[model samples]
Target: MGPITVTDDLARIDLDVVHRWLSTDAYWALGRSRETVEAAARGSLSFGALVRSDDGDELVGYARVVTDRATFAWLCDVYVAPSARGRGVGSALVRAVLEALEPMGLSRVMLATHDAHALYRRHGFGEPAHPEWLMALQPTPAASPATPAV
Candidate 1:
């Protein structure tokens, strides 16, 4: 990794690159559709990591934050390409995101991760003090006609 450039420019993002990683490689978004991924990109502030190459620049990483720009921000859909992993791409992306949000004076920034806790902790993230106060409502996937009822 040489001189990785992280930017919030949506113009620089390649949707197909992002969708490919999210749908196939990312555990959180496995089997996710391109339409869903595109909608997410459209609705949130996006960041992209581009590395300089002899031919041109390549989009090697991505992250998006859904924020009200006043109160709260939820950081989600962070993915670094397989070739970009373990080379500070993830850390650089997180730092860029934090810097971007700093001007907004947000009350809190939150993210859910089954792994990579250490990476985030290095950037000042920690376990919620009041986990009991937090809750989620993930909808069950619709059943198909071929599926038998319990």
Candidate 2:
């Protein structure tokens, strides 16, 4: 239990630890691969973190938001390490990410979650009333391969 901080640059991130959190069978799963996660983080306008173990600081939790720093953004791959669950890591991660981008003057930030709606709600995320108006198309494994092969 050290401190939680949000960051945008993932080339500076320790992805292996973040990957461990994603591998856990908790809350929801994105089924993302190492390369994709790395790519997403690297490409994102903002990425966030909640480091609970500073001295031994493994990347206990994380959240990522991809945006053009303007009117649209998508939040994705939010996770907390299994061992670090039940604490406020997820909440803090979400908060940190969201706060970081407020200055960009985004019209809205949208996200899709299989679970954890409450967490999002706590941070001012809401469901669209016209769910029917916002039809979605799921991607296939072929369409979204986990990661590029080394």
Q: Quick one: best TM-score, which candidate?
A: 1
Q: Write one digit per residue (lDDT tens) for candidate 2, span 131-150.
A: 43221221222333222111
RMSD of each: 11.8, 10.5
Candidate 2 is scored at a TM of: 0.71
Candidate 1 segments exceeding 4 Å error: 128-150
Q: What residue pairs are clashing in model 1? A: none
Give the worst 10-residue stretch by lDDT in candidate 1.
132-141
**TM-scores, each model vs. reference:** 0.83, 0.71
Q: Which stretches of candidate 2 lie over 4 Å from their true place?
A: 23-31, 46-55, 128-150
**By lDDT, who's the top model here?**
1
Per-residue CA lDDT of model 1 for 69-137, tens digit only, reads 886788899999988899999999999998898778666677787667768767767543354322111
Candidate 1 global TM-score? 0.83
